[model samples]
Target: MGLRMASGKLRQSFRIYEWLDSHKISVTSIAESIAITPSMVSHTIRGRKNNRRVLKKLVDLGCPQEFLSLPIDLEKQVAA
Candidate 1:
């Protein structure tokens, strides 16, 4: 619905980290699944990371496509 980044970088405001925290999903687990380093995941959770590959992998693992879009509204995210 907006001019979203083509790279699909994950943004902190989207609260994907909160969901992961609630589910007890560790950064290491995500890193392993995505073939990336844990530091990358940690940086992302801390809002200092942005990688298209990482975002793509996260999406494939069930992160909503909305998270990759601009002006995300957490209230509108579909339930997991």
Candidate 2:
């Protein structure tokens, strides 16, 4: 089976996308820098995929670490 998009956009993913846009960073550029396909980079940004190399490169390029990991639901955690 193929990977499918998440039903809802992840919080971290949205933040990362916004940060990339604000910084004028393009998925194509990141992909080229890492020798990966643009689709893979896009997928990673959208939370449909995970790639350590891509994540590392984003951080190296000044992306905030908070936007690179899954978001924790503090409310849910407190309730649990």
Candidate 3:
């Protein structure tokens, strides 16, 4: 294992995906901007990817700070 997140589960809903969608920015476009794959971006939104580098990139791309305060609720979101 390279780096394991302290919390195996992500602990917040990073709204980056929503922002990108609302702004009509394609995942590929943002991925290119951040030098990460589109799927990595998708996984971040879904709370499946929790690498520090990716999290930092999301923040740089305008992910709100408030999202960091929201508790992780992947199962709840999935159920809804």
Choose the strongest candidate by TM-score.
Answer: 2
Residue pairs whose backbone atoms clash in candidate 2: none
What does candidate 3's lDDT look like per residue over 1-80, in tens digits? 53333442544544555666777867687678778898886666666766445555555666664453223343233235
Better of 2 and 3 by TM-score: 2
Worst 10 residues of 1 by lDDT: 70-79
Between candidates 1 and 2, name the one with more favorable TM-score.
2
What total of clashing residue pairs does each candidate reach?
0, 0, 0
lDDT tens digits, residue span 1-80, model 1: 64334322445434777667777877788889888898887665554655545655666667655554422332233223
Cα RMSD (Å) per model? 6.4, 7.8, 9.3
Model 3 CA lDDT for position 53: 52
Off by over 4 Å in 2: 1-11, 70-80
Ranking by lDDT: 2, 1, 3
Question: Highest lDDT, which number?
Answer: 2
Q: Which stretches of candidate 1 lie above 4 Å from their native place?
A: 1-10, 69-80
Error of 3 at 50 (Å): 0.6
Per-model TM-score versus the true fold: 0.55, 0.69, 0.55
